[model samples]
Target: MPAPDLSVSATSAVRVAATVLWTGPDAPREIDAPIVAAVPDPRGWAAGLDVPARRDLADRVLTQLLAGEPVVVLEERGDWLRVVAPWQPSDLDPRGYPGWVPRAHVAQAAVPARTEAVVTVEAVRLEPDPGSRGDGLPSELTYATILPVLAETGTRVRVALPGGGSGWIDARACVVRPTGDGKHVEAGAVFTEARRFVGLPYLWGGMSAFGLDCSGLVHIAFRALGRIVPRDAHDQAEAAGRVPVGEARPGDLYFFARPEKSIHHVGFAAGPGSDGVLLHAPRTGEQVREEQMNADRRATLVDLAGRLAD
Candidate 1:
């Protein structure tokens, strides 16, 4: 069955595991068709893009929306929707991070229940329980995707979807908590979450477990622990408390930029001191890695690190 058309001025939620937010309707390339489809294959799309093609994404993409994340639809053009993700704060739009996404990737928002289940693992597939008329096949959910809890059996949990259907996920794959709990793990734990993706490939505008951009890594790490940070490096730098680099500790954010320029890169501080090591998803064609703060990085490293926690 076809998904209903998104109405302007209404709230919507992403229905895929992850969907790329393009800069504009014209931003996507032929190679990006797979990712813009109703059922996106983010991993396959990432694999198909060679180095040059991947690098080109920096200009074409804005950010990514995880399954069930809400967006405010502002305009519609053919197969595209201009929306703002209110959960992902940004200076670009007063409402939230603004971008263009395929209309087919989202559906009208559902009224959420009192409890929600947050994905804890890197990725998990959600399927319907036997004998239940659910929606389509199993859908992949990435780290930090949150869905309202509907029911729970011994080892499986039924969750509500934005598309007006339900699916079951392994109880072991997520943690159930009261809606709007606002709880968060300590800095050390946030760093631990970031460490788990060390070898993951870097994808521009990516925020899912399949791939991540520099700021997306930090954003999702904190989010998995129930903290909401800005969605871009420059905004994140401004939101966090500034700490002298010499006093930096684990979980602090390391931002990089030329003098008098906007911050372009961000990473997690892996140790203490001015030359502390970093764990981050580097540029295109590179994988997330932990490395010492080298000379080249030092020259551009912001003198005062951004501190989200101790």
Candidate 2:
């Protein structure tokens, strides 16, 4: 079947648990078919690949989009869609982070009018109401996924999916709030949220609890608290206020780069008095971890840290 002719500027919602945004349509390998499919299984995709294969994904995978997230359609190729995700800010495009994702992973739908709920756990099951027709909804939703709340009952909340139909999740698994609610979140709270993914594996361009890249870790952590930061390290550094390393505070961002080079990595400062403890998703083969700022890391550490306004 042909994909619908979604005009430029049309808004669509991601309908999969985590859709891999590829560098281009030809970037995905045969083994990556599952992840690029309409009903994606991220865990299955990851589990099937070994360390080397997983690391190789960096060459093609640009980023990831969680279920129900909004994207503005820019163009459509044979089986891929070029879209801008305004929620994930990046200097690459003024509109938002620019990327290509499988067209099947997103759909045009009416933006629901209701309070939004953000998934707060690693993953939560979405169950259909008794005898309700399934709409190919994902069985699990990853953290930071936002959807409109349609109805609520004790211990369960029904959410309207972007592709249509509603699914129920544990009421306790999400936090309901008005869309675009702006509130000051303490740096300590942001640090606390980031610490939750201490041991998650590093995936290039990843942005969910399933996996995360350096900037993605910072992005999602801040997002979980209703704060939206840039989706990449350089943009984040460019946008945040600079703070002297000696005065870095907990939850402050630590950007790393070689002399005269672009910012390539980011992490949270674990500071009581700027002792230089850092928590970050290090590299493709490593897991997110915390370590004291060693000499090697200091060599590339930016002199000034980044602090987002409260």
Candidate 3:
């Protein structure tokens, strides 16, 4: 059978099999390790370093896989599992956005039964009790992190964690919505949500509101509207129908790829023409913001365009 058209909303219940670090959509490639041994030169060493070539699977993360987030498994190649990550949806690949993860990293045996809830806050601490305490879950949960609501106590909601555990999060911090609610979401709503992260730091491979890369920003914004776009710029460009630059509208995606001649960056079209603004997270250190695509930057934009909202 052909891979399902992932451009449309589709979901399955599965969890991260293990505390596995995410490799990109493609299969993993082994490289020489021990940075010092791999790259002997010290001058301009940092600039010349190939991070993936000298790192462990744990270090090359596109995103962290929580134990219970819903995922759609697409294919299996021996020890590796190609999966469609719900958080990182794609349009080009029918199997949903492929995340070439280890088979061991995907757990499908037992998914707890409970109501689904999405984290609404930027970051929320999971606690054993409703009140703040010194000992909470080891880390804070970011926005859009899914959880199974087991119980509701005063102003707090108990939820299942990725690993084998349960914790209480503020009731106000999460919103329970049906899986089918996003299909009819509005473009304005999508753009409105994108504007909230205007000052957030750009995190490569980040899909949550706390931090996200350029494409990550676009992915999350569309997700809010209940639509899923491809995870990378090039794939997204291919998946979406083409629209000339002159006809761009709000909620439309503006892809940027220059020198390399491939889509590497993407942003939301907020206005029209030269006075129009793009909402995007530019680079590693930059924050998500709305800015005019200057002539030089706009020159590199490809004619391709996509719309996630109906």
Candidate 4:
């Protein structure tokens, strides 16, 4: 699927899924998580997804290419996605951005044909909204979107999306440009650099645990170190591109949800291990601390959470 021409500004972070969702006919449904990426359905059933959802809908769609249910997907503008699922009505416009994508079980697609296997992975693209404070990157940039890159042999290493799907790239004809400082997300640097704020108080809407919200900690900690991230749980949920939580290194951002996986809160990925531990500013009058990532503990609230960022 080819993407439509849409305008984007520098400083925005844009993330693409390996697979995409198209607009559905008209079935109204909602998935879990704070930030949602969805496409509209002409009939009305849109494919919805959230990080907090059971299947991690966004991942399922992009990585697997198919949302578990029977649905159609459209490649929206560059870095944008859409959905078309059952229960949607035909009166809708599948071409427009109906907003949030829904949650769903997705099916994985087989590897691409040998002809399309030619490719290269570059630095992740973080697209923020237009006029973002990203310093020099696009405001709507997410992780990497197989943009057109030229290979030394004169062949184009066309980029696909984290959304799944490949295209051809010309080695010489296509020009691949470098964008953003990439400082906020140092590839080799684990989030360990952000652990300095531990013991700060947990405040509502607070940035440094001196009263911080889940996403607040992420924003403040990274920003303090010259790294920029999104505000709010939803925004952060779409931030820093995608990395398996299990594979997360220190300094990585960790999103948490109530038992519902609603993306209600977020935390810093302190270290790795099944201990499921994360660092955050505990709530009001509390201090920042490294708490267990116990699924049950996170539900009813655990280890006195805190706010971490701006």
Model 2 regions lying over 4 Å from their true place: 1-10, 129-132
Per-model TM against the reference: 0.93, 0.93, 0.68, 0.36
**Model 1 Cα shift for residue 128 (angstroms):** 2.9
> Candidate 4 lDDT, tens digit per residue, 4-104?
11111111112223223323312223432212334322111121321233223222321112111123344344433354432111223433212223332
Per-candidate clashes, comma-separated: 0, 0, 5, 127
Worst 10 residues of 3 by lDDT: 32-41
RMSD of every candidate to native, in Å, equals: 5.1, 5.0, 7.8, 15.9
Local lDDT at 251 for model 2: 91
What is the descending lDDT order?
1, 2, 3, 4
Cα lDDT tens digits for candidate 2, 1-310: 1111111123588888889878888999999878987788987886677678778887798788888777888899998899988777778897778889988889864366547788999999998655445567788999988887888887888887766667899999999887666777788998999999998888888888878999999989888777777889998898888989888888998999998889989999987656889999999789999889889788999999988846
- Model 3 lDDT, residue 152, Cα: 81
Q: Cα lDDT of all candidates, in order?
A: 0.83, 0.82, 0.58, 0.36
Candidate 1 residue spans exceeding 4 A from truth: 1-10, 129-138
- For candidate 4, the TM-score is 0.36
Q: Which wins on TM-score, candidate 1 or candidate 2? A: 2
Off by over 4 Å in 3: 1-59, 63-67, 71-87, 90-114, 129-138, 162-164, 180-182
Point out the worst 10-residue segment of candidate 1 by lDDT.
1-10
RMSD score of candidate 1 (Å)? 5.1
> On residues 174-251, what C-alpha lDDT tens digit does candidate 3 reach at each position?
776553344465667878878889887665565665457788777666654446566777776766767777677777
TM-score of 3: 0.68
